[model samples]
Target: MRYMSHLLPLSRVARLVGQPRSTIQRMIHDGELDTFDGMVDMNELLRVFPDVRWEDDGEFRRVEEIKEKAFARRVYERALPGKEVLAERLHELGREFAAAKSLLLHYDRVHRFLDDKLDDLAERAGVDAVATLRHWLRTELEAAPDEAARAEALLAQESVMRIMSATVTVRPSGHEFFVEGNDTILEAALRAGIPLNYGCSNGNCGECRARLLSGQVSKSHPHDYVLKESEKADGVILMCSYTAVSDVVVEAGVAGAEDIPVQRVQTRVKAVERLNEHMVALRLTTPRSRRLRFLAGQHVTASIGGDAGEYHVASCPCDDRQLTLHVRRDNRPFARRVFEDLRKEDTVDIEGPGGRFVFSLESRRSPVFIAWEDGFAPIKSLIEHAMSLEISEAMHLYWIAAAVDAGGADHYRDNLCRSWADAYDNFFYTPLSADDGLATLVERVLAAHANLSRVDLYVAAPRPLLDAIREAALARGLALRGWHGEVIEPFPGAPATG
Candidate 1:
C-alpha cells in the first residue's frame, strides 16, 4: 500500500532516531539512507531502521517528562517556544491535521459511492465478478495497514518535535540548527555555533536581516529596525526578532574572522579559578544585551584596574554570556592584578577579539589539535566549537605539558578533556610530557598519524615548536591550507617552555 510522504529535516531525523547528526549524514553519504532534497521521508526512516520502536524512543519520554514535571524550570522555560510562537505552530499543525482528515473524509465518500455502484451492477446483471470485486474492496479497506501502530507512534513523535522546535537552514552556507524554546533566529544560530552576521542582538542595528525563502515565522520580539515595504514584500525579516514556526530556509551571510567588527564590552568577573599554582582560569560574564562576538580560537584584550593583557579566549562561542581566559602567573601587571586583587563582580573591559587562528568552517577533514603548555587555551576553544558543529570526522588532541618542577604547565583541565573523550566516540585525547624535548614529542605526534593528507592540523605553541610541527606536517603531504598555527609567546620574566 502507498503511504503519504512526510518529510523531516536532517536534524529532526537525527533527533528522532536517537543518533548524532554526523552519524545520520554519514549514513546518507554511504548510501545506507536516502533523502529527498536533504530531507528524510518518514517511510525511508522506517525502512532504514526496521527495529526501532518509535513509541519507546527516548524523545517521547523526554517530552512526557517536560510536560509532567516542568523539569528544571529554568531549562524548561528556555527550551519552550513563546506563547505566540507556540500558538502559531499549533495552528499550523492543526491546519495540516484538518487537511488530512478532510482528505480521509473525501476518500470515505468515494469508497461508499463505488460500493453503491458495484451493488447496483450486481443486482441489475447478477454479475458474480462485481460482487467479488466489491467484497475484495471492502476487505482491503477494513483490514489494518501493516505499519499502522508504528506510523501512529512516528506521527505522535513528529508532532511533539514540531511543537517544541523548528529547523532553520541558511542558504549560502547551508548551516542548519533548530530554534528551540523562546529563542529568536539569531539567538539559536549563535547557540549552535554558526557565526551568522549580526550586531546588537536586541534588534537595533538591523545587521541580522535575512531573506526568507520558505516556511512560516512569527514576530517574537519587536524591532526598531523597519523593513522597507519592498523588502517586506521580498520576505525579509530580522533574525533577532523572528521565531520560526516551521522548518525555514533563509538567505544570510555567515561571518568570518575578518567580517566581525571589534567591540569592547564591560564584563563582570564571575570567578577566578586557580587551576594550578602557575595558572588561573578567569571567567567573565558580559551583559545580556551586549555579548562578546568572536569565533573560537581568537584572542581578546582584557583590562581590569587600568592593567590590560592580551589572552586567547578559552571558551566556546556557543557558551552564552560567559568568557573564559587562561592567565599564567607572571610579572605582567594584568597577571599580577588577577592573582592578587581581581574579585567577583569587579568590572573588566574586553576588547579586540584579534587573531586569524580560528576554526576552519568548511573543512570536513579530521582535526588534529596540538597544544604546548598554556597554549592549550585556544585549542580548548577550537575543540568545543568543533563539538558544537558536530563534525562527522574523528578528532585527535595532543597536549604536551611540562613537569611542575621545571616551571612548565600541567594539564589543568585534564579531567574535562577526559570527559569529552568519554562522551564522544569520535574524540581522542593524548597527553605527552615536554620533558622529552620538542623533537621527540613532535615525532610521537607525527608517528600516530599514518595519513596526514586527510587531516587538518592546528598547533598552538612557541614560535619554534609551531614552525617545527607545521614543517613536519606539511612534509607528510598535509595541505598547506589545512595547517593553522599560533605562536604563543611566554609572558615577561616567565620561564620559556613549549
Candidate 2:
C-alpha cells in the first residue's frame, strides 16, 4: 500500500491545485507541505487540498499513482546492485549524528560543571563568574589554534613572506609605497598616505583599476568588476583586490596633490569636556614646532598607555596646533580611560593627518553634510574649513541623532548650526531623530536635496548608516563621484580586563 503512494513534484502539485509554483514552494518552505527530495506524497496533497476531485481528469490521479509505483519499483530494482552501499552510507550518517549529539551533550555537561567551578573561583577572586570563564575559554581557545596550527603556519608564513615583501611604485605621481603582507595594494597605499582614486574600495567600481607597466601582481581577492581579455593582456589590475608579488611599477593616478605628509606628534591634552553622556570633546595642544598640518575631514590615531584608536579631527586646520576630537565612550579601554582617567596636560602620541576624504576645493557645487552620532566630528571640521575657504556654494547640514537624549543635549550642535544658517545666506541645518528609522530619514534627506547629482555629499557616519545612505543615494540616481568626504569609526572592541 505504501509503495502505491503517489509522490509528485512541486510543479505537478501546483499545476493540479491551480496555484502558482511559488505558492506551492512557499507551502513546502513554511512546512505546510511535507516534501522528500523535492517530491510531495499524493496523500499529503489530498489532505492539504481536500476539495479537489482526484478523478476529475479521467482517472489521472490513479494513473499518476501507478506511474509513481512503477518508478519506485524501477528505482528499487536499479538500487539492488548498490543496496549495501546505500545501507552503509545511511549507517555512517546515523553514527555521525549520534557522535555529534553525544559530543554536544558531553560539552554541555562539562560546561555546567565548569560554570560551578568558575562561580567558586569568582567568589575567591571577586570577579563575575561568567566573565571569568569567558576570559579563560577565549584564552584557551586562542592557544588551541597555536599548537595545532604551528607546523602548517610556519610553512605558510615562509611562502607568504617570500612573495609579500614587495613594493609598488605608481607612475607620474612617482609616489612609492610598500605593500604590507596580507594587504591589497590600495589598502597599503591608503595606510601609507598614498592617495589613489578609488570608489567602493571593495572593487565594485573599477575606479581603482591601474595598468601594470612592469613586474608582477596577482589578484589577492575577488572582485565583481570584469576585465576584458585585451585589458588583461595590457596588464590592467584592480589595485583594490591585487597584491604585488614583486617590485612593480603601475600607472595609477593620485587623487590630489601629494604635498600633505602624515606625521607623528606628541601633544598634551588641554581639556576634555563632556559633549554628551557617551561623548567627550578632547582638545590637544601640540608643540609649536610639531604643529600638525592636515586637510579637513582627515583622521588621526591617538595612542595612550599602549591603547590606540583612530579619531577624526573635529577642529579646523586653521585652528593651528590645537586638535579637537570627539571621543565616544564605549567598551574600548582606551576610550573609557580617556573619559575617566585622561586629564589636562596628559601626554599622548598622535599619528596621521591621513585620509583622502576631503572637500573638492575646486568644486562649486552645493555641499551637503550628513552625520550620525559622533560622525559630526569630521563634518564639523569640513564645515569650518569650507567657511574659512570662503566657498560661497550653498551648504546644508543634516544631523541624525540616535534618540532625543542620545545627543546629550537634544542635538547639541544642531541649534548652533541653525543659528549659523540664520546668519549666513548659504548655510542650512536640519536635525532628524532615528525615531522615524533610517529609511525614513534617508527619504527625508533625499527629498530635501532633490538634485543630489549636482551636490557634493560629505557623509560621516558608521558603516551601517553610510551603506544605507550610499544605497539610497545610488537608488535615487546620485553619482558615486558626488560623495566627497567620509570618516567612519567602527564600534570599539571590549575593554581589556586585568
Best by TM-score: 1
Evaluate model 2: give its lDDT: 0.69
How far residue 477's Cα lies from its native spot in candidate 2, in Å, is 3.4
TM-score, structure 2 vs. true: 0.46
Q: Clashing residue pairs, candidate 1?
A: 79-181, 80-181
Q: With candidate 1 superimposed using the best TM-score fit, by how many Å does residue 386's alpha carbon deviate from the native?
A: 1.0
Clashes of each: 2, 0
Q: What is the lDDT of residue 396 in candidate 1?
A: 97
Residue 460 Cα positional deviation in candidate 2, in Å, after optimal superposition: 1.3
Tens digits of lDDT, candidate 2, 124-171: 787775676668775764564432343233223322322324556688
Task: List the RMSD of every prediction in angstroms.
Answer: 2.4, 29.7
The candidate that achieves the highest lDDT relative to the unseen native structure? 1
Taking the tens digit of each residue's C-alpha lDDT, what string does model 1 give over 1-498?
546999999999988888888899889989999999999999998889877788887777877888887588987898788888889999999999999999999999999999999989999999899989999999988878757777788889989989999999999888899999989999999999999999888878899999999999988899999889999999999999998999899999888899888999999999999998889999999998889999999999999868999999999999999999999998779999999989999999999789999999888889999998889999999999998988889999999887566677788899999999999888999999877777888899999998899999999998878888889889988998899999897533334554
Error of 1 at 382 (Å): 1.0
